[model samples]
Target chain A: MTRVYLDNNATTIVDPKVYDVMSPFFCQMYGNPNSLHSFGSETHPALRTAMNQLYKGLNASDDDDIIVTSCATESNNWVLKAVYFDKILNGDKNHIIISEVEHPAIYSTCKWLETLGVKVTYLPVNHDGIVEAHTVKDFITDKTALVSIMWANNETGAIFPIKEIAQICKEKNVLFHTDGVQAVGKIKVDVQDVEVDFLSFSAHKFHGPKGVGGLYIKNSQELSALLHGGEHMGGRRSGTLNVAGIVGMGLAMELANDAIEYENKEVRRLRDKLEDALLQIPKTFVVTSRDKRTPNTMLISIKGVEGEAMLWDLNKAGIAASTGSACASEDLEANPVLMAVGADKELAHTAIRLSLSRFTTEDEIDYTIDVFKKAVIRLREISGSYAE
Target chain B: MAKNDLIGGSIWEEYSNKVAELMNNPKHRGRFTQEEADSKGFKLIVADFGAESCGDAVRLYWLVNPNGDIIENAKYESFGCGTAIASSDMMVELCIGKSVDEAVKITNLDVEMALRDSPDIPAVPPQKMHCSVMAYDVIKKAASLYKGVDMASFEQEIIVCECARVSLSTIKEVIRLNDLKTVEDITNYTKAGAFCKSCIKPGGHEDREYYLVDILRETREEMEKDKLLQNANTVFGGGTVAFNDMTIVQKIKAIESIIDENIRPMLVMDGGNIEILDVKDSGSHTDVYIRYLGACSGCASSSTGTLFAIENVLKAKLDNALRVFPV
Candidate 1:
């Protein structure tokens, strides 16, 4: 059975270059990165080179700090908790600003702060899932601690004006954080141009091993440590380093940055074709922002069928897709993002998210389109009088 | 994207065509109406007896002469469903030459037996019995008005199927409809005791050997009790609670009536509508079912709406019961 995997936004296949670079560290150089021994020293050079790759990709100054963590979720949690608590206790700021559609890692954590007496003002996103620059500026008050937004929506791939939002935040003297997990490798995201105080990235989203991601801290304001422990990420987070994962992630970032422009064109073309072919099927509609989108993502709603049923049919035909955010699938709630876009319950439940990768072939896209079309026909026949 | 690619044949088009055809059919989904009636005695100068309960088992109106003979013609009117209306028409046809006592003895069982050969009138619930009893009341009333006759001392009251709220008068009217032959026939045609088996006989037979007079007296007592309960339900306002089907007061009246009328007669007839199942509360709902007896087991639609109706009425009356499911 030939499976055409398209849910890259959930997680991508590991790159061979990343694998090759990290392979030796698993055995010959198994020493902890925190250790001062020769084995550890051997791994440090690779880690430095990986950081250099990120620095160039982000256009960061030589002194900009990069602290690694498990994944983008952890990076987000660390920023929200660290920044909010630090300002509340030390900087005397109690109000926080965030976009309405920030990923749960940022939005949910900030919501939790309300119980602790911290007031959060969530800036609204336009129908396209983009928060206006002025909206962020208006939300920033004298007591505002931070403003957090997303670089690109994971479900719709709608990119926000992060640089403009960040510049406005800078002018207002409020901290800015951007969850760049969807934008990092898929788009040319230069954090220096955006000038955000913090940006989150995960390795697994761009063809590296999971359980390894980082936050870019660009300013001189010291962040409170998320973990209390001995020498690891300069005591910022505890536990011995996931040496192999970190090495693979460093290698993945370098490779993603080097060929990003060409890869962007290839995936965007494939993505557009898939979207067009899918919409050609009866009763299918694209749910993402069309003119501006992440090069590799397409979310569509198929009328008269449940998304889970369609997923099962597609899975049988060896095509991988998602209903919405992968995290929301655990409880089987309708996608909140689709709901925010004013989709009715039926449309929200019927949405299928197909995310392409740099290596996805045109042939696979065509095969998926054929399978998708057939599945919709078969499902409608089974449903009988239940029409959407 | 191109609009040309979006055009195609789909199942929705097929459904639209089917709907057009369905609209032309006579039995096409729509509302239908029916009228029903049940009354008491007949006329002439021959044979008269105590027929207070007879009218409830048969549905028709009758007039009697000074000497107890049935009068050839009598005026009749009824307000009920289609079968009940047809049952009233059938009663007039069946009793033109019968004596007043003979007409009084006639049950819904006899009317349906006559209707077996009549193709125009569909067999219905034994509401004819109640109509027959009502006919007897009118005849007695008219006789009293004309000749100053007093017969209150001879009157008897009875209750039959409790779940259906059937009384001796009610049963006589049902019998006048001429559809029900046995207790189970009542269950099938009228939805009586189908939910809880309070009226049905135990072993699938009508148990006709039981004395009708004793059952009638017992039912009278039960009716009095149910009247009280019904009044209580009215006072409390018959609203089903969030987790219950019938209100507490409604359930009380229903259960009381069922036990006194439906269950007692079946027991006397050497059969019974036995309690078989009780469903624990599920979520905010509850359900229950009872065993059918006499002829009720063979009833087709009794298993559907009739069953639910009994359960629902009881649940509403017994507000705490939640919901009822048949087993």
Candidate 2:
């Protein structure tokens, strides 16, 4: 079967160049960075090289500390829990602000912090699913410890005004954090330009290996270590370094950043072609316009067709796609991101997301469009609501 | 890049061959209209049931033999996941050639088991188990509309797990028979407390009178007591005698019946009547939301005297889990 993967937002395949770079670190020079032996010191140059690549890719300065963690989930938990201990516990500030449509890494962590008496203000999104910078200014209070928001929504791919929000936080003297998991490699992510105190990103989203991600800490802020034992990552994070994953992530970051222009032009053109073709089907509407969302993403809802039903047909045709709703859960919840975008209950269930990467070709896009349109027609014919 | 390294897990792989087959080409996918039923001298019964949140709905069309109450033909139109399409197809297949009562007796587990590619395996993933449950609920909806009775009447036993439709008696019996000790064990055997888990204890989707925690505890104590008695006398009784015993659903039916017999007429005599909107399990209490019709809509005694009067009547006759509210 001709497999056409358009589910880039979920994760990505490792680039061949990235895989090649990561291979040598696995069997050879596979030493603990903490060890002082020759085996360990042999890996020091590679680690420094990888770290430098990450800093340059993110446009983070030398003064900023970039700590490599397992994934963005850890980066999120470390930042939030660290704030809870540093400020919230000392009664310096007990309130935090975050956009309601944050990924579960940020959303669920805030929910857990709520049990610890940390007051969380989940800033509501507009109909466009964008958290307005002015609204962030309105919700900020004297006791506000941090304001964290997503750079781009995972479902709709709606890019938020992260730089504007960061500026507001700076003026208010409050720290700013952005979950840059979807934004870093997908878009132009400059920690200097955005002026975000903490930015979390993952490697696998940009065709790097999994189990490796990084946190960009501006000025190496006073935050508690999430893991305590080894003095690795300058004691900010404690664990034996995943040498291969780090190497792969660094190269992937560089490659992904280099393809930002190609992604904006070529990938976006393919994405728009797929989106426009899908719109030709009846009762189909895009969640965000091409200009509003990321270049390589298209979230559309087909009237009266359940998301997973459409996915099944697409899957059988060897086209990979994703839905906004939790299709796997028994308690079927409408996609909160879609819901925030002012989609109705039915539209929320019908939402399907197709995200492209630099590797996506025009031929694959055309094949997916053909398969998806047919799936919609087939599913709608059998749909109870649309049978008439 | 290696192809394996690029690709993530496929959600479609979680489904069985039977499920994918049915989902793609379901025999019972079409609907039966009244015209078709009239030509065959059968009653056309159409039923629709929507999930509270998932937006998944199933519409069942039944061509029933009015004389024998046998479903001459059954068809359905569903809007849900792939598993839902397969489960609905299997549900309608189970209904054909069976009496209405027999179809109503078909549980969600039966629907799931019927869709299995092999007898020992499951047709769908654990997450899609609720699709089978949706199939069962729609059956009750169709059966209730056809029988001209409350849908609650079709429910006989105390349903501990609404997701799996595993009843209290069945859970207890399974606990004893399989020597299931923990809540997880009961979940494995009967699938009770597996999904949603409102019936397992308080602070879930809903509160249940018979929680798995209390059921496991009480059934264990009774088992110990029965063991002592068995040691005293070297004879043992067979199991599953009262596994069919009705508890909460039977109590609900009883409560509704009492209100119909004792309370409705009295309120009607006062130029007013009451309609039961819903009876939900909230913690240890069963909250009944009602709407007073005619003169009882804004009656002076509706809050103080009449409300308590209805609550007292249901509580006095039925279980104390009943709490009456005029909505």
**Leading candidate by DockQ:** 2
- Per-candidate TM-scores read 0.54, 0.79
lDDT (10s digit) by residue, model 1, range A1-388: 9799898998999998898988988879888877788877778887788777777777778777788899999989888889776998577899888877788898889879888888998877676666789988777789988888899988878888888988898899888999999998888888777898999999999999999999899954578878778878767778788878887887888788876886677888899988888888776777656767888888887765556556656876789887752211212344666666776554555678899998899889989989888877755543321332
Candidate 2: give the clashing pairs: A13-B6, B286-B321
> For this target, which candidate reaches the highest TM-score against the unseen true structure?
2
Predicted candidate 2 versus true structure: per-residue lDDT over A329-383, tens digit per residue: 5334577777877776767688888999999998998888878878877877677
**How well is each residue in B106-184 modelled by candidate 1, as lDDT tens digits?**
4554544453434443232232223223324433444444344564522354545422435556654454465344655
Candidate 2 residues B50-167, lDDT tens each? Answer: 7424657889999999989999899988888888889899999999999999999998889888887889887776556767777998999999999999998888877878777888
DockQ, all models: 0.01, 0.24
lDDT of candidate 2 vs native?
Answer: 0.85
Show model 2 residue runs off by greater than 4 Å: A34-37, B1-14, B51-53, B168-190, B195-327
